[model samples]
Target: MSRLIYMGFKLLEPYEGKLSRTVLRGESGSNPADLPDKAIASPLMANYILYLYKTMRKFWGEPIVVTQELGDILGNAVIKDSILASSDTICLLDQSKFRGNYEQVAKLLALNEVEQRKIFTINGLDNKAGRGKFKEVYIKRGNIGEVYGVEVSLFQYLTFTTEKPEKTAVESYVARFGSYSAGLEAFVSDLRSSRLGLADFIMQVNAE
Candidate 1:
């Protein structure tokens, strides 16, 4: 029984813009300025992933699997090399890698509607050409347990603020539409109260 934890968190804006271009880009790095605006924007996401990776390392003392989102942006060879240099593993989190027998369990326990929608979009299930492709491509590729693993865990770190004047985009969006959309605050409140129970549930599911 290998130890596995699946963790994820929403992207947050960094304080003070503390991550420098050189630090993020690494030595002998390409000038992000030369890249397209979209390419340049990805470094911030990559930096955040790195931050999470380091933070997780402190707790688990092990290498971990990460989503393709992280892998796509952290294209710098030096930084990637540094990550791989560690004794633990850092493999791509893909459907193909999932273990058998945990598929239904994952669908029932791991994903909510929002997450399912996101997965649908990621795998092009919503696209005309790719309609109904999610089951064929995504789910068939791996069970949730295989993708997240026992060592994998998700963390959603949101900086919520009621200060209307200083609200971030996400906060504003939630506030404006939360009542109609999905009771975002209520969900968070429930999550806070039931997190321990959720963890236990996951452990029990994995155990079986």
Candidate 2:
């Protein structure tokens, strides 16, 4: 076979297990790393289909046939669209990343303490770290860059003053709100302010 053909085969061979086929050969016999260097796809041009195939096979199983003629369903399958749209539900908790004119966000938020607290959640979402204890207030923008069909253009500014301000508080605040609309609003507001010491404020907002 031609070198290109060899390379293509090597790239695809590892993912063939994803297809629902009864294999005379061992179903799990696939190794892209075993191919010669010349048979490997370039990192930039690597096929996503092949990658998904391998990933699915590894995650799902060697055989995906739902032989359900006489079987009991175990659990519910998670729909793909639900996962995709779920990210939009996240809100901003920070008021940092908005520098210069963005200081106005803080001022605006402070103007209405009730709205400020409303934007700042007293409890955070449930995740690996457990439920969030404090709230955040921020503005939203678009995604900053793209990854996995998602664009990350949002920016934010954050503040969570307590009895004793700790670094972790700020980190948690930024992590929660740094990607949504409220965060972006805070960011743009600060950028437009152009006040003296604004650089310091920006640094403080995103310090962690």
Clashes of each: 17, 46
> How do the residues 11-80 of candidate 1 rate in per-residue lDDT, one tens digit apiece?
1223212224233433232211111223312444445445644644554433242333333324444335
- Measured by TM-score, how close is model 1 to the native structure? 0.23
lDDT of each: 0.35, 0.36
Question: Candidate 1: global Cα-lDDT?
Answer: 0.35
Residue 57 in model 2: lDDT: 50
Winning candidate number (TM-score)? 1
